[model samples]
Target chain A: GAGVSQSPSNKVTEKGKDVELRCDPISGHTALYWYRQSLGQGLEFLIYFQGNSAPDKSGLPSDRFSAERTGGSVSTLTIQRTQQEDSAVYLCASSLWMGGPEAFFGQGTRLTVV
Target chain B: SQQGEEDPQALSIQEGENATMNCSYKTSINNLQWYRQNSGRGLVHLILIRSNEREKHSGRLRVTLDTSKKSSSLLITASRAADTASYFCATDALQGAQKLVFGQGTRLTINP
Candidate 1:
């Protein structure tokens, strides 16, 4: 079975630029989540989507951080006006709802804001 | 914000030796999960223990949870050099809507 997949393994951009990271969840997975990992730091929750319900954006660091999961399958995380603090590994995960409770992760997109 | 804090930021052990890591978290949780990440790779789920359950096992990995103490521990038996990686503990807090709050992580180095 194919696992979660993310595109653009690495991205380098200037400050104030915008970047988009893409994630494709496994087939039949209904729960999707995005997290950030800074160097030598813990995983930081960013956003989550479950089915057609509203997405949880509480963990988003700022208004510049936004994510959208379209058609209940693929998702894109966009950081508008990126800052050096936003530079980190963006990870995507998918699960069969919380009932199953095991999340499959993607390789992640390493974003570098110079 | 991170809810869990792992002890011993780094550890080194000889191959075939056992290793243990502990995590302490604030707030009640629905479940506690352990994940392993190789260098420059995505995290892989190791084991999960519900707040109600005390312990879980997957192959050489063993996880124990103590809801009273708001803590959890992961023990790896007969660790191999390939097992060298970073381990993290994540908590599914009772208040959060199924989000996993992770700890700072422990870097394990298995010396062969």
Candidate 2:
């Protein structure tokens, strides 16, 4: 796809189970970001990955939340021991590079933890 | 905390009317961007205004930036029913890696 691609458009999981969301950025894009949006609320920055540089994880809500980017391409966001509060649409975006051209977004993955 | 905060949680107007939305930020930003989301799907970039430039125009969309006040406004002139969507303002800080801090957003409903 020409734009960012996210896997499992919708996911339903048990409260104590773990869930993994995937993101594939546009070809040649070096900057990728992850954000979470709860119903009727603003987007919450979760993590960022820039080509080979250390990802900024300042926005991850808890120790259970983690993410990784391999080969500077595909990325995955993992939530361990998910809680009901973890339900939200997880969005992924990628830009040509960091802080420059506008980023392109994926449709996002809506996760529901029951 | 989110850096950008948009005013008027929601707005509704008829077709051909103009719509305006405001956003305020706390810190110095290198740039500000507007994005539109339809049906809560992926966001589409609208326009971007840099700190150096006070205003920019893209078709019917006009954007203004005030650095001293640390705020920006997005205006959609001659709107249509197709314009109904949620608009968000995001700020790229002067110092950070290209991470964008987004506001809660304004839900705009344009009646046909």
Candidate 3:
């Protein structure tokens, strides 16, 4: 796809289970970001991968949330021991540079933990 | 905490009427951008205003930035039913790794 691509548009999981979401960024894009949006709420930054630099995980809600970008292209977000509170739409975006430019977004993965 | 906060959580206007959304940020920013999302899906970039730029225009969309005030506004002229969507303001902070921080967003509805 020319734009950012996310896998498993919708996922339903049991509480305490784990799930993984995948994202494929645009070709040659150096920056990728993950954000979580709850129903009727704003997006919360989760983690960011920029080039070869370390990812900034300041926005991660807990240790259970972790993400990795392999070869600076495809990325995966893993949630361990998912809780009801983890139910939300996970959005992925990619940009040509680190900042100061428009970003391309994926359709997002709606995860429901019952 | 989110860096940007949008005003008027929800808005509805008649067709042909202009709609405006405002966003305020907590810190210095390199640039501010507006995006629109439909049905909580992928968001499409609308416009971007750099801190050095006071205002910019793209088609019927106008964006204004006030660096000193740390605020920005997105004005859509000639509203249409197709324009109904959730609009969010994202800021590229000057500090840190220069990641974009998003605002809660404004839900705009246009009636024909």
Candidate 4:
């Protein structure tokens, strides 16, 4: 089975610009999550979606950061007015459900804000 | 915010040696999981231990959970060079939100 996939393995953008990263989860996966990993830091939760219900946006750092999952399949994470501090690897993962199941991850989009 | 903290940010050992990593969390959890990530790659789930279970094993990997202490340990016996990667522990708090809080991770280097 194909695993999770993300687009734009590397992205370089100027400060204040907006960037959108895409993630394609595995087929039949009902749970999707986004996280950010900074250098020498741990994984920071961003947002999560389960099925077509409203997403759990509690982890989103600010209003500028938003994510949407369409048709319960693909998801897009948008960072508006990106800042240099937002530079990090954006990771996407999908699991069968939110419980204690294994999560499959994508290669991630490494965004660099210059 | 990160929920777990892994001890010993980095470790180095020869192949065939046993490697042990520990993780401690602040809150009660329904289950704990361990993952491995290669350089520049996404994380791969290694094992999961529920709160009721004390210890579990898979191949050469061993995971132990201590709910009383809110801590867990992962032991890799006879580690190979390929096991040289980053290890992370994630916790699913008892709240049942389904979101996992990950640790800072441990970088293990195995010399062949």
User: Candidate 4, residues B1-112: lDDT per residue as tens digits?
Assistant: 3389998799999999999999999888888999998874689999999999999999999999999998999999999999999999998778757688899999999999
Q: Which has the higher TM-score value, candidate number 2 or candidate number 4?
A: 2
Kindly list the per-residue Cα lDDT of model 1 for residues B1-112, writing each as its tens digit.
4389998899999999999999999988888899999875699998889889998898999898988988899999999999999999988767657677789899999999
Candidate 1 structure quality by residue, lDDT tens digits, A1-114: 499999899999999999999999999999999999998777888999999989989999999999999999999999999999998999999999852488899999999999
lDDT of 2 by residue, A1-114 (tens): 588999999999999999999999999999999999998888899999889999999999999999999999999999999999999999999998776569899999999999
Q: Please report, in order, the local distance difference test score of every candidate based on alpha carbons.
A: 0.90, 0.92, 0.93, 0.91
Evaluated on chain A only, model 2 obtains a TM-score of 0.98
Over 4 Å off in model 3, which ranges? none
Instruction: List, residue by residue over B1-112, the lDDT tens digit for candidate 3.
Output: 4389999999999999999999999888888999999999889998888889999999999999998888889999999999999999999878766999999999999999
Scored against the true structure, residue A110 in model 2 reaches a CA lDDT of 97
Q: In model 1, which runs have C-alpha deviations exceeding 4 angstroms?
A: none
Best-to-worst lDDT order:
3, 2, 4, 1
Cα-based TM-score, every candidate: 0.95, 0.97, 0.98, 0.96
* Residue A75 CA displacement from its true place in model 3, Å: 0.3
Fraction of the reference Cα-Cα interface contacts (below 8 Å) that each candidate reproduces: 0.59, 0.67, 0.80, 0.65
What does the TM-score come to for chain B in model 3? Answer: 0.97
**Highest lDDT against the true fold, candidate:** 3
Write down the DockQ of candidate 2.
0.78
Q: Which 10 residues in a row give candidate 4 chain B its minimum summed lDDT?
A: B92-101
In terms of DockQ, which candidate is stronger, 2 or 3?
Answer: 3
